[model samples]
Target chain A: MRITELFDNGEFVVTAEVGPPKGISADHVVEEAKTYLSGITAVNVTDNQSSVMRMGSLPACVALKNAGLTPILQLTCRDRNRIALQSELLGAAMLGIDNILCLTGDHTKMGDHPGAKPVFDLDSVSLLHTACQLEKGVDLAGNPLVGEAPKFAKGAVVSPCSDSVDAQLAKMERKVMAGAEYFQTQAVFDSEKFIQFMEKAKQFGKPVQLGVIIPKSAGMAKFMNKNVAGVHVPQWMIDELAADKEKAKAGITGVELAAKVIKECRPYCQGLHIMALGWEAKVPELLKQAGI
Target chain B: MLITELKNKDTILSLVSGKVFIINCHGCKDIHFPEQEAEALQKELAAGGNVTGIFTTDYICNPENLKLRLGYHAEAIAQADMILVFSCGVGVQTVAAAYEDKKVCAACDTYALPGYQGVTPLEHDCKQCGECFLNLTGGICPLTACSKSLVNGQCGGAKDGKCEVDPDMECGWERIMRRLAQVGRLDALKCPVQVRNYATDDEVKSK
Candidate 1:
């Protein structure tokens, strides 16, 4: 089902971020999605996530689709040029992958293959525009597709916790104008800041699914704060995570923290995109504790 | 103008098998020359009697000026086994193409000078993405300013006004927002959706 239909029906959407395997088998992700993330609005399969070469997203998405699951096919501008990108989108559409997540993607410099060429053929906004054009039956060159036009519910990503809120809002307007039907924000840790961003971002009138990353431990929180862009783990949360010196129980505490934030941030967003970050089994527990 | 910096002297010497003629493009003079660095290397190389001749030229990217400048160096260039260029990539390519029969090498490596610059003045890079976002951005060029060249807006990665990719570099969009607010043109950030002209974007990505 398209996320728009979920929204139109007033469903509080929930999604999970899943990475395609480095090898060919999509069975692990498929099984994981089924066992732990059964109720998610859609399973998002990332494209060459973190610039590490992986099995293509479409294969994994197709596997999930074969299992009767709605999959958001993630497309990034890092590896593919416009031609490859559009062709991939068309392929996904033909394969019944209706949800599209368009991203400018992380630079190759940050990825496993720093030497790989970073082809940002189109930034996220332009890609969204192009996706809409394709859905409207015309490609970027204004040429019509020979077959039936593929339809998609194009989605964009945002960083509500960006240092420059005004600039972010400015971009939100562009994304919305570019035909971004929905948004999934970068991992957000600060609800106050997220609330502030949401207050202004409300003007764009698009469904924003806030990302809630579950930090497994104080060490993880600190690492995220220092390394991850757009993710700022607050001192209080770190202190709370650090209080669990037992470490074994800290993972549970981390789920509780994530759930707590999700509860607090619920009103500000149309959905919650949980990024368990390898702690997938705990997501079910986190949602349960959060009373979702 | 292009910024040029001298390459490692050891590497240059290793590449120097025979007589070498050098040309320095001072067109971007006073910007980021590494002139003293180049001269220091030259002084060391000249001590070996391997350097045939050396001269400085301006606007070596200009084909006509390049012809006039190289006209004088024709003899030295012929006498030398290799022609060493100290300029940006464009000037180096121009020299290599002009001297296809000669062994041409770049003695200096060019790095991006943040924002676009020209022959007349040194300003921030424009990227010339064809669809300028400056009018909507209070004259700040997001393509050059932002580390990712993300023109839509600032990414969430910046912290303490620093870029996510490079901690030392200030976040470009933060600067733009500050400037926009300073000029009371914050609304200008949304004047038009900054979709780069497809024709121009294709050209940029091809490189």
Candidate 2:
């Protein structure tokens, strides 16, 4: 079923992210994704997430869709220009990949290739607007389409942990106005803050999926806290994971914390987007532990 | 005016540890230039007899003007082991280019002061993020004015038109919408937001 259909049918939507491998082969990642195919509503394929040059999200999503799974292809403005963005949107639609998540993408300095020139030709808002234009059978320059317009279930990212909630909300409003049908927020650890965000986001009257990350270790939590913008892993969680001596037991604690967060936040959101980092296989266990 | 704070004391003293010549720029006319801070530090350095000479010049960003000042201080410039620049980045680059052999370094980080109108610094700042939305947003820049630098509408973080990040500041979008309402151009908000051409500035800079 289409992701939009799942949302419309009032199925508590579940989505998970798939980071394309650094190299070209998508076979292993696609095979790993199949294990949880029955659990998630859709799988999000990242576009060189963290500015690392990886296999393009398009082909990976195509691979998943070919394997009989719904795929949400992430498109970041950091890599492509408007022309490429519009062209790829149509291309993805042609290959039966409809869902798209627009992002401004992380700056190039955060990636493995810091020397690479950043091409933030468009921010997420403008990309959404362009997607809407393509949906209407026109190009960015208002040129008439030679063929049919692509149909896509457009989505965007929101950060509830933004230092400026007012500014972030204002940006979300613009995204909504431009053509974002849904939003998946950045990974949130603080339930109170996420709940507060939901209280305000509810006013937008759109389907929002809360982001939850499963950290493998205390070192991972601290690293994310320091490196990732808008991701806050509380000190107590860090302390709890740090207190555990065995790494395997710490992994279990991290999963439990993720499940606890999911249980607490599920009421406020329409769905959950589990970003396992690299631990995608354990999502079913997390779902079971959360009693979802 | 662009604000510039002096570099940390340790960094400045270390750079000025050897025979040093100071070049203070009056370029861009930033109201926040720390003349007192520079003077106090200079006095301390002179008390220890580390100072070789000090010179002040306007338009140090212009290499020709800096060259003239360098000519006047040739003796001290030749004697000094290091040239300490208490100016903006542009001035530091200028001094460094003039004397390629000397170890030239900045004593103050240069901040871009926006609202340039024939050399006057305005309170507003423009990040020049390739795409200009100033014509649409009532001349207030969302790139610099908004905390998140978000191009879309406001996030839920604003309360009573004040920014959630800094309550003292007005929300950029709120201000845009209010101004648009006043001008009866609220329809502009509904227009397709343009994709920013990040390459625009890079191309310009390269040229």
Candidate 3:
């Protein structure tokens, strides 16, 4: 089913993300995606999620579709200019990939390879506007096309747990104005803080998907809290995960913590996006625990 | 041949507050005067608004007379707070060199017409860098020709002969193929595609 139709059907939905393999082949990641497909509404395929280059997101999305799952292709403006971006958008639509998550992307400086050149011809806001224009069958210059352009259900990311909530809300407002139909927030751990964000986001009248990151270990949780921008992991959760030394036990604890957050904020959000990273297998249990 | 008043001479002298005698050699005739635009400026100047004096020649047409004209207009320019050029051609360059520190503004958008064959106002299109890959894909530039400018191939929206974005223009690749076929250069279309540089910095620097 089309993602927009699925969204309109209005049940509490579940989605998960699968990072593409670093190499050209999808064999390694496709098997991981299959485990969570039945349990989730759609799976988001990341585009060079970090600064490190990897296999492109398009083929990975094709792999997901071939496995009978809907794929939300995450597009970043860092790599492609306006021309490349529009071309890719049309290609994705033609290839039967509908949902798009537009992102400004991580700066090249922050990626594994720091020396990479960045192409930011249009920022996230402009990209969203371009998507909106294409959906309406018009070019970026406002000229009407001879026929119809493809329709895409565009989504954008927001960081509710940013250092300044007001600044985050302002950016969210701009994204909404630029035609973002849905928002998937940055990794959110603190429910109280996210609830505060929800109160402000409610004005824009769009669905918000709270991001849940499943940390592999206590050290991973600490690493995200300190290094990842807008990800705030409370100390108590870290201590709880730290208590479990066994790797299996730690993974279970991470899923359990995410489930708790999902259950708590389920009333406010449309869904939860479980970012398992390498731990894609645990998402089913996490969803089961949350009773979704 | 044309007589135009220097409206700001008195006010400019008052601002500088001196006995300023200004002579304009370019006179006010050769500057291309669309009757309506000239009338509008005259009304604006007569309403006691800022009006720099007019020029005698269309700057682009009469290049040789520009130096002589600038020599005539130098006094008014030196005395005033600003020197505005309403002419086209070499008159602009002449005045620019003479009044190095004076405020100078052109009422015309700048463009280079072929040689001095008379100004054939060119519309700004995609900047044509020497790197011509349009030959490989067809006559349509994958860079400027394509609605989306897909490098590898046409986007999904390339329906029939029209673009999915704009149905009127033939798809960039389609145009390229047709043009190559027409010129019988289809065999020459087998080069490895090189990415076109659309950098704004190079275009801006050239301008």
Candidate 4:
């Protein structure tokens, strides 16, 4: 089905991202994914999201699909050039993967073993344009494909709380013009700030999904606020999580906070993309409590 | 850049400048390609353009070798505005660490290679992280071998068993199937398997 159909249906659209494992067939990863598939509209399979090479994203996506769930394949430009990127897109189309999230990956220097090299031949913007070309059955250099190209419901990322919000908006506009059908923002905490950013994003007339991270612990919230780019966890929320010394109580409090955010942002966003990190199982309860 | 292999101390010392310096391991005085790149870069800087510092080092085979190599590249990296790596293997990581603070770029496209070569060459065919599912699915890697990682897929563009992406190469899965058939292991294609997550926190050091 087309992304437009999915959006118009307004089905409390919940999407979760699952990281593939490094070794062959680990029951733990599959078990983790199965825990939350029932609560989400689709599950996203990340493509070496942070540039630390892992098992390929496509197979993981296919696994999710095989599990009677819809999967959105996350593709990155850090490793592949225009040619490889286009080929992967076509392959996704053939595999019945209708959803894709485009990204410019982290530099190789960030990965373990800094000796690994990076391929940044094309950044995210160019990748967006390239995807547009493939949808139209042409290559980046303007050559026509020998066969018909596959159609994809393309999406891109934006950090609404970026230090340079204007710069982020400009890139978002570029992505929209380049055939991005939807957008998912980075982790958001401040609803008022997000509302302010949405005032500008509203002009684009495209659907936006608010990114809600399920913090594993109070410390995890603090770490994300300090280290992860474009992610902000309010101190009050952190304190609440810390107030609960027991692990189970902390988990409950964390879910309550996430549910509140989901409720507050529901009116503004078309959907919510939950990044549970390794806490995929808790997502259903969080969503259920939010009345989503 | 005209890359050459460095051979001796005089050649190494001759290449040193505020813009060019020796980037070699300890207990050794030899010139290598990295040194050659440095000399060329020095010339480029002298010619009056905003040029950066260059690397001069070797791919280390041991921890001691790594330390010596890191120490040498760190000096050039500390002083130069940019650091460019021309070789592969441990050299890539060594230079990246030494020049972590500087702008780093690779001159060659890095790929996963076979392990037969002692300390596999930097140019690898696949980034093997020990998630080998190639043993299944006809020896063709749906993850890395296929240009598009499409399982149970062969694009209509496949002509006479060759990939439409490039006529000279066999389709990744097709080649795997052939190899599996040769070994009478075609039954390895059983249930669809999920791709493993080979990434680790250790793999992600910087951002």
Candidate 5:
């Protein structure tokens, strides 16, 4: 079933993202998707996330679809121009891939290949609007296409932890106007902030899936807290994870924390989008513990 | 007005091994221009050999003004083997245009000063993507400020409203958010502006 249907059908939607392999070997990509297929409404395949070179998200999404799991092809504008972007969208439609998540992507300087020139021909907002135009049998310039237009269950991302809620909501309204059927926010660690964000976002009357990251250890949490943007890990949560020196105990605490966030945010959000951050094996465990 | 730092003294000195004349633009009087670089170069050049002349001016970009100045030092400039220009790219180009026979080189490496190309440098830089979103981002240019250059929202590398690439630098979006909130224009961030025209630079260059 399509992700939009899952959201519209009144089932609490659950989505998870999977990073494409950096190399050609993607046998593990499929295996990773299978690990939590039963627990997720759909799986998102990231496109060159963090500006790192990786196996294309398109083929990975195809692989996931073949594995009997719904795949949301993650597309970014950091590497492609409008022509290439539209061509890939048509390709996804041909492959029976119906879901997509639009992102502007990080600059190439942030990746292993800092020398690569970034082609941000279209930002996330523009890309979403372009996708909507392609769905209507026209191009971004409003020119008619020769063939049939593509169809997609379009999705976008938002940052609930932005410094100003009004500004963030304004961006959210643009995404919705651009035809973003749903939203999966950046990793949110604070439930109070997310609840407040939801209160404003709900006025748009769209399904928003809160992002939850399951940090492996206190050190990892601290690293994300200090470095990652749009994410904040409360000192109390860090102290809890750092309470123990045992790695196993830290991992357990991490799960408990993710569960706590999920339980707290579930009341306000339409669903949870679990970002395992390479800890894919723990996603199912988190779902079970959160009683989802 | 942009930042132009002098190249290594030894490296520059080695490039012009004969009689040298220096031309520096004090017109913009930009803080990032390293106002003393021309004098330092003059002193170092004098130590090596005869320093022909130091032509100082405000509008180095004005070809007419530069030509007028060159007329005054025609003899000194004629004797020099190379002319070193200390200014921004526009000034360097103007100086190069004034002399066709002489080897004109930039003694300073020109860079985009943070913010607009105006006199005073701010904490922001605009890539000049053409479609101005400053009205939306509270006058901050996310295209050049954010390490990721994310337009719709902030990246995952922000911590406590600071950029992940540099902890000391406040996140551009965070600053934009705060400013937008203060002005009650936070709603401007909602409507996604049209796709950025990458050809803006090309069009300007062609003109």
Candidate 6:
């Protein structure tokens, strides 16, 4: 089902992130998704996440769809120029891929190949505009397509936990205009801040999914707090994770913490976008623990 | 003004060999020239007897004037094995274009400057992106200042009022929000999404 239609049906949709491997085979990801992501709404295939080289999201999404799972193809502008971006969008459409999440992507400097030339010819907003153009049976140059044009249930990202949110709101407005049907925010750690963001964001009249990253360890939480943008690992969360570490140190250590955050934010958002990052097996347990 | 920061001394010195001709542009009305830094490097190179000579000029981006000044340094430049350019990217480019055969090394890295064109003393920069967003952003140019160059809005990477890309750099959107709030025009941001027109940039347009 299209992500937009899921929201329209008033479903509390849940999606989990899956990165394609560095090599060509999508077998591992497809197997992982089939095993654990059956309960989720869709599989979000990342496009070279963290600027690391990986199997393309287009192929992986196709693989997931063939495996009887929905896929949201994350399309970033970091690697491709405008020409490739437009071409890729059409290619995704031709492959029966409809859901897309447009992003600026992490800078190439953060990737494995820091020296690779970053091609951000179009930013996220412009890319969304370009996508909308393609859906209208034309490209960015106003040139007509060969036959039937592609349509997408487009998504964009936002950072709700930013110190300053006014600028984000302004940008979110632009994303909507540029054809963002839904928004999945950056990793959210503080629920109170997210609630406040939701108050303002609700006016847009679009479904927003809260981004979730389970704090695997206290050190990881601290690292995210220090390095990740719009993500603040409150002292309480860190302390709790550290306490969990003090215990058995096994079987989803962050489930309670994840559940707490999910329970708080679930009321405000339409869904959850859990970025499992190799911990796909834990997502179902987390959802159940959160009483979803 | 084009603000140029000195590259690592050891790295710059490695590229330089034999008797070198130093062309330093005390440019930008000398408002931001790292004169002391440049002089310190020159002293070290001279102590080793590798410096053949030193030539000082301003506004090296001005090609016609720079061509005339090049005549004065021709003898010294001819004797040197390498030419060390202590200026922004524009100055280095001008010198490099003038002397294609001569190996020219840039002693400094230019930061957040517009074309490195050596224009005014003003701190702000405009890349001439054609479509202006200054009105909505309270005079701050997201294209030039924001590390991500996100015209639509601020990214989620800023922390402690600093940019996600560079910790030392101030978050561009934070500055814009402050300015907008200060001017009592914060509501001006309730506008539409900004889609940058790549048509103005020929390089981008071709792609």
- Best of the candidates, TM-score: 6
Docking class of 3: incorrect
Q: Candidate 1 has which clashing residue pairs, if any?
A: B115-B124, B115-B125, B116-B124, B116-B125, B116-B126
Q: Mind giving the per-residue lDDT tens digits that candidate 4 earns over A1-292? A: 5555688777556788888887677356566777766657888788876666788888777777777778888887667766798888888888888788887665555566456656555556567678878878898767898777877778888888765565466557756766778888887887877889998998988889888887667888878765566677888888878877585354788788888888888888898888888778788888889887
What's the distance in Å from true for residue A58, model 4?
A: 0.6
True contacts kept of 1: 0.61
Candidate 5 chain A: worst-modelled 10 consecutive residues by lDDT: A162-171
State the DockQ, from 0 to 1, for candidate 1.
0.35
Alpha-carbon runs more than 4 Å astray in model 5? A247-250, B1-157, B178-184, B190-192, B200-207
With a 3 Å backbone cut-off (N, CA, C), the pairs that clash in candidate 5 are A170-B190, A228-B156, A228-B157, A228-B158, A229-B156, A229-B157, A229-B158, B27-B58, B115-B124
Report fnat for all candidates as fractions from 0 to 1: 0.61, 0.31, 0.00, 0.00, 0.52, 0.61
Error of 1 at B7 (Å): 38
> Which rank order by lDDT, best down to worst?
6, 1, 5, 2, 3, 4
Indicate whether candidate 2 or candidate 5 has the larger TM-score.
5
Worst 10 contiguous positions by lDDT, candidate 2 chain A: A162-171
lDDT per residue for candidate 5 within A1-292, as digits (tens), equals: 5688888987799999898898887789888779755558889999998888999999998888888888899999889999899989989998999899998787687888989988877878888899899989998878898777888999988889865555567777878888899999988889999998898899888899999998677788788766666778888888888887485354688888889999999989888898887888888788999999
Error of 2 at A21 (Å): 1.3
User: Residue by residue across A1-292, what tens digits does model 2's lDDT show?
Assistant: 4566666777678899988998888898889899865567889999998889999999999889888788899998777877898889888888988899998776676679977877666778888888888889988768988777888899999989865565567677779988888889889888889999889988988888989998777888888765565678889888878777485354688788899898999899888888977788788988999888
The candidate with the higher lDDT, 1 or 5, is 1
lDDT of 1 by residue, A1-292 (tens): 6788887777788989999998978899999998888877788999998878999999999999888788999998879877898999988888888899988887787778988887776778878988988988989878998878888888988888866666677777888988898899888878899999989998888899989888877888888877877778899988988887675254777887788888889988899888777778888888888778
Write model 6 residue lDDT over B84-177, tens digit each, in one string: 8887656665665566555566776554434445454334455545344554555556777787777666666678788866799998878767
- Tell me chain A's TM-score in each of the predictions: 0.97, 0.96, 0.96, 0.94, 0.96, 0.98
Give each prediction's DockQ, rounded to 2 decimals: 0.35, 0.14, 0.02, 0.02, 0.26, 0.35
| CA displacement after TM-score superposition, residue B49 of candidate 5 (Å) | 65
| TM-score of model number 3 | 0.60
**TM-score for candidate 3 (chain B):** 0.34
Listed per prediction, chain B TM-scores read 0.55, 0.55, 0.34, 0.34, 0.54, 0.55
Segments of candidate 2 deviating more than 4 angstroms: A247-250, B1-132, B135-192, B195-207
Q: Model 6 residue B82 lDDT?
A: 70
